[model samples]
Structures are given as structure tokens and as C-alpha cells.
Target: MALSPCGNQSAVPTTFLLLGLPGLWETRLGLCALFLLLYLLTLVSNLLLLAVVWVDTHLHVPMYLLLCALATSETCLSLAVVPQMLVALASLHGTAILSYQGCKAQMLLSGGWACTNCFLLAAMGYDRAVAVSDPLRYTTRMGHHVCICLVVGCWLGGFIVAGGMCGAIFWMSYCPGQNPLNHFFCDIPPLLAAAQGVTAPSEAAVLLLSLLVLGGSVVAIVASYGSILVAVLKVHGGRSWHRAFATCGAHLTVVVLHFGCASFIYLRPKDRYTLERDCLLSITYAVVTPFLNPLVYSLRNREVHTALHKLLVQRRVEG
Candidate 1:
């Protein structure tokens, strides 16, 4: 059979190499175990947090609703990349080869969930602003329909944006000799670097589009939080202001970690593609953020804590 150049018969490499953290030979086992533990915590904690939000009547508020969405997105985002990474690390495969389709799918899901999270966090900031600025109209303004719309918008926007970026990335020909990805999964930057010769134009376009999406999202988030800070300051009572700050502080911390790491990775110029820095930042968002989200939100939220206690008691009685 004569194989077409554009088809799968283009002699596509079945496996790709993954070059993990630069110099961790001494701590390889320790690092893998730590990441494994973190992944377990991320999965269990996020699922529990989501269940609590769903079942607890006291948590039927805008803040908790947004938290649930955030948790869900984080779960998806982490699942898209982390488990595969763990497997690769466990096997100690110098080069991990993923099928072409699998690589594309992983990239799609990761980018989609990450982008959706960006918008969802912004929506959360907006929700906080309304809750603080118009305490009287908070319920009416952030009603069921409005919340659904915002959540839907975030997801839909993320899907479209990520799809576009991934399409731009994969719409190019590939020759031989470039199969190893520096990172675990098929991230945009690493993939682009791999396709250096045959798809230079497409790679450049993908990089630009990613920058625009990430840069614009960061600007929106900053603006939303700027307004939120202003609104927080105008409250009358010291106690009320302090409570508001406390409520939003955890969210602010997560937002900073997410955007700060992502910006350092994506928004920087192509000339600054340091493998060490890239790996570190990727771990921050892909690993650390997922584990932190549940801890920060669930532990700090009195309602979640109370509901969990009740559920535990109920389980004990049933047992």
C-alpha cells in the first residue's frame, strides 16, 4: 500500500522521550513518592469537597457554588496529566512514547480545563465583588440562572479557545528526528519545540495564540480582583471587612499561584525556555495547585467543615 505523506503512514514515532527535572538523581525516589502522595490527596480531597458542596444545604450559596466548579475543574486538569506522568516516572522511562492521538487528546483536555479555570476564577472574583459591594442584592444578582450562565460561559469559552490553539499546533507536517518531549505530556511549548523543522509557522502561531489567551485572561483576573479589593475596602465595620478579606484570601492565594506560575511559563519570550524553570513551574500548577485547592477551601470554610463532621457522625452511626 502506498502511504500518503499526510496520513498516519507518515512514519510517525510511536514513542517520545520525557526529560524530567534537570538534576534530581539523588531524590528521584523521594520526589516520585511525594508526587504520588500529592496526587492521591488531590483526587480524594477534591472529590470529597465536591460531594460536600453538592449535598450540604448550608453550602447552597454563590461562593460555595463557585468553589465546587473550581474544584471540579482542578480535578479534571490534574487527571489529564498527572497520572500519566506518575506512570512514566515510575517506569523510569527516559523516553515515553504516546500515540499521536493520545498526545493530542491530553493536550486538548489540559488546555481546556486550564483555560476554563482561568475564566472560572475570574467569575469567582466577580461573584465576590457583588457579594461585598451589594450585600442586599447578592442573592438576586447571582441567582441560579446567572450562576449557570457564568459557569457555562467559562467552560464553553475554554473549550473553544483551547481547541483553536491545539488545532493551530497540530496542523503541520512532521519529518523525522524530533520525537522527544521535555515534559511528560504533550504541552504546547514542548510540542512546538519537537516540531521545530517541519512546522515552524504553525508553532509560531500556536505560541502567539497561547500568549494572547493567557495574557488576556490574566489581565481580566487582575482587573476583577482590583475591583474586588476596592469594594472590600469601602465596607464600614472592621469586623465585616475582616471577614470579607478572610473569605476571599484563600481564593486570592490560589489565583496568584495559578496565574503567576502560568504567566512565568507562557508569557515569557521564547528565548527564555529554560528546562529547569519550565519543569518547576509546570509542577506548581499541574501538581501543587490541585492539592492546595481542596486544602485551602475546605479547611478554611466553616460550612464544609461542619457538614463533613455531620456526615462522618452519620456514617459512624450507620456502621
Candidate 2:
């Protein structure tokens, strides 16, 4: 906690102002409405996927179990950021102020849950590879216990990573007058950008740590998919190829969207930041990505679709 200059009291760096969507004044309301719709869609779709997976015995396999865990993470991620963003967007000047506790909480949720989603994607990719490459050994290799361990590891690892990064950010002293963060929620770059002074090293460390986590997951996903590709090509069966594509395509789409949107390609020096573009990227990743995740999973998965259809049909029959 840093001391506020106004009074020599133990003042935490509370009340951060988020600049939700700067320079988009004209379209802010429309964007807000659009994101509100997308937010709701993400919630409903992921929750439905979870519920479907939970009750349906057929979706009890490792792949579907991983997917269910993913949906759960996505639901948590969206809830952590979207509602607060909506509130921020409705505010005057597109600035939403958050307490230190709230800011740190959002960072933990978004950061940890995003890490969970990334690792889950990698895990899902690995699970698919095992299925495609060694169908016979898939069940034996990826037993229920192994699957549980993988999911738990992802969730736990994400929290540890996020806790380290957020703790680093929150401990720094935020200078007055640098209150407006370019993104909708409290994130690493923005928080460091607004810190008092001499934070480059800390910021670099956080970025490096984040890259390490993401990079490791990416390596795993690429390796899994690469092996999957080789195995699918070696097998001259069209059905095998189709199955491989169906399993990997959705996961790949999600990977591309999530990483592409969240990547720091446009991240220049702090003074050179283009806030509107940054906010747009944040919004796309935070809002649109979650909405797309379950859509891709559900449409590509026949078993899940079948389960969902049966559930609806049974409800209608009972009615």
C-alpha cells in the first residue's frame, strides 16, 4: 500500500479508472449493446454445454471432459470482465473506476481463467492427438484420473501465475493523475503504464512471465497438432482424416482467435499506445472469444449436439 499524498495514511492503490473505449464516442452505445448481447450468449452457451456434458453419459470421455472444463473457465472469465465492462461503457467519459480489491480480483479472474482456457486448449489438442494417433491406447493412456489431473493442473497453474503477476502489479505505487487505463478491465500493461515511476523492470518481468505460460501451452498445442497431422496423413483413410480435422479445427480456431486478439502486436511504448485499438482488442478477446468458444465446440461435436437435441426433445415431450 502506498501513502496518499493528501494524507499520510496506508492508502492502497484503489479506485483505478478504466478508459473503456476511447475515441469511439459515437459508436460506444451500439458497441455496448452488441457486447451485452454477446455476453449473454457466452453465458448461455457455455452453461448449456456444461449442463449437457454433466448429465449425458456419452460425453464422459476425456475430450468432452476437457471441453466441459473449458466451458466452465470461459464462463468464469466472461463473468469476471463483461458485466463490469458494460458498466464502464455506460459511464460518462467511458471511464470506470475500480477499487484496488476489485481491480486485483478482476485481474486474478481474467488472468487465471484465461491461462486455464489456454492450457485447456492445449490439453484438448493433446487429447485429440492421442485419440487420432493411438486410438487403441487413448483410453488407457488418458484415464479418468489423468484427465482430472490435467484439468486441475491447468486451473491451479493459472491461479499461481495470475497471483504472482497481479501481486506484483498491486504492490506498486500508482501515481496520481495517471488514472485512466486504456483497456476496459485491469490488466498488466495498463496498470504498469499508470504506475508511479521506475516500473519498467517489473512490467517486463510480468510480461515475461505471461509469455512463458502462454508460450509453454502453445508449444504443447503445436507439438500435439503436428503429431496429429503426421499420423492423420500416414493413415490413408478419409474417415480418419475427417475425424482429425473435426476434432482439431474448432480448437485451432479458438487458439487463433484467442492468441491473435490478445497478442501485443500493436503494443508500443506506453506513451505511444493507441487506446482505441487496444480497447478494441481487449473487447474482442474478452467478449467475442468466449462467445465463439462454445459455438465452435458445440457445432463441431456431434455427440454434444446429439445430447443437446435430446435434452430439448425430452423437455418438449414432458411439457
Candidate 3:
């Protein structure tokens, strides 16, 4: 039982209250509707991408396999954060309560998925690099077993890093009457603020772990893209260079959006944190970027369009 501000012990288990998107109760419903629409679109678009990848035998290569993993990660990330955000927004006071255990689970899932995506993007960059650099050897280099291992490694590394960070953050206890979390979901910065008994060592540990995950992934992506650039420039024909870049440009766009948003939120100092500003930025990574991923990939990739068309045509013929 946690002690309330009035010095009364609460009989119920301790929980954290989320003050969703601070200030704007009048616009909460509108925001809720908008987020719902985006979440639904995210689900549909990612699912369609997954279905296309699954049904098209032509897409059974390394690139689409990595893309399938990314789509899955985006959907899971949104599921972990957005529904609860909508519930919080629907509250009359724009606040929602989460059980202590529930909050921990959310932190783990959301953080884990976010980390997983960074690694997956990095893997995709490498896949593209290999495909462009050595087309004849691409299939052998990125065999099914290799892709499987990469996917498994990304997932494991993400969860392990997130578990460590979450462990460090949850090491401290929160008072029942502490200020509500400024963000909709259970994230690190707001939780750090509301927690008591947070020591310098724990804070330093979390920061170091974050740097390793984000910084290391950024390094991997840059290296992969650098190799891709070298390979593209070495190609003899104009069409070859154009084709290679076309394959990589969409990925670069997503990498920019995701890493930019994530870096802004996680890599910044706690002193620079603001309720309204961080919350809006959080929505970008958690909601908007996921929503944009499928669009960016599908709109730009002719292979995806062709695969989707074939799938639709096959369905009609089967019917």
C-alpha cells in the first residue's frame, strides 16, 4: 500500500496515473478520433504489406523478409502504446490509471519493440547494401537461415536492452501522490521524473544502455548506407544506379523519420524535457511514423505494387 498525499495508506495496490497529452481536454476527443484513425490505417497498411509478402513467391527474398519483420514490429509497437493512449484521451479529464504490473508490461513491450525496429532497420540497410554491392551473390549471402538468424538476433538484442533499461528505471519506487506521468504511455523520462529513490548510478546506467542501443544501431545504419553509396557510384550504367538507389531511397526515408524521432526523444537530456513538446514528439514516433512506414514503402516500390496487384488478381480468379 502506498501512502497518499494526505498521509493515508491506500489499501489497493499502487498504480500510476497518466495525464495524456497535457492540457487540451477540450481537444482530447478530437485527438482521440485522429489517433484512432491513424492506428486503424497503420494496422491495415502493415497487414496488407505482410499479406503481400506472404502470398507472393517472388517476394521470398531477403529484402521483403526484412520488410515483413519491420511491418510486424511497427504493428506491435503501435498496439503496445496507441490503444491505451486512446483510452486516456477518452477520459473526461484526459487521465487514465494503470496498474503497477500493467505499467511495467507496457514499458517492456513498447521499449522492446522500439529497440527491435532500430535493429531491424539496420539489418535492412545491410541487406540492401549486399544486394546492390553483389547482386549475383545476394541470395547466397542472405540465405533464409541468415535472415532468420538476423531477425532472431534483432528481437533478442532489443528485449535484452529494453529489459535492462526497464529494470534500472523500475528499481525506484513511486509515491501514490506523485505527479501524473506527462506522456500517455509508460516511458523512461516521465517515469524517471515521478520515481523516488533514483540514484545517480541508476540514471547513468540507463543513459549508457540507451546510448549503446541507439548509437550502435545508428552506426550500423550509416556504415551500411555508406557501402551502398560506394556500390551505387561504382555501377557502370545510369539505369543500374537509378535502380539501386530506388531500392534504397525508401528505406533511407524511413530510417530518417524513425531515428530522428527516436533520437529526439531518448537522446536528449532530461533537463530539456517538456510535457507538451515530448508528448507531441512521442506521438510522432509511436503513431505517425508507423503510419507512414507502409505508405513510404508501398508508394515508392514498384515490386510491392506488382505483388499486391497479382495477389488481388489471383483472389478474384480463385473466386
lDDT (0 to 1) per candidate: 0.78, 0.81, 0.88
- Candidate 1 weakest ten by summed lDDT: 1-10
Mark the 10 consecutive residues where model 3 has the least summed lDDT. Answer: 1-10
* lDDT tens digits, residue span 1-319, model 1: 2232433444546444666654765666677788889989999999888887777888888888888888999999989988777766766543356777788898899999998888888888888778767779989999978998899999999888889878877775444433667786678777766653356567577667667667777777677667766776776678877877776887788888888888777665455677777877888889899899889877777878898988778778999
Instruction: Tell me the tens digit of each residue's lDDT in model 3 across 44-132.
Output: 99999999999999999889999999999999999999999999999878889998889999999999999999999999989988988
lDDT of 2 at 141: 91
| Winner of 1 and 3 under lDDT | 3
For candidate 1, report its TM-score.
0.89
Taking the tens digit of each residue's C-alpha lDDT, what string does model 2 give over 1-319? 3444433333545478887656777777887899899999999998899889887888898988998898899889999999888888887776688887788899998999988887888888899889888989999999999999999999999898888888778777764433668778887667876787566666666767677777887899899999998998998878988888887888898889877775662224456556666667777888888999999888887888899998899889999
Off by over 4 Å in 2: 1-14, 176-178, 265-272
Please identify model 3 stretches exceeding 4 Å from their true place: 1-12, 177-179
**What lDDT score is found at residue 52 in candidate 3?**
98
Each candidate's TM vs. the true structure? 0.89, 0.91, 0.94
- Lowest lDDT 10-mer window, candidate 2? 1-10
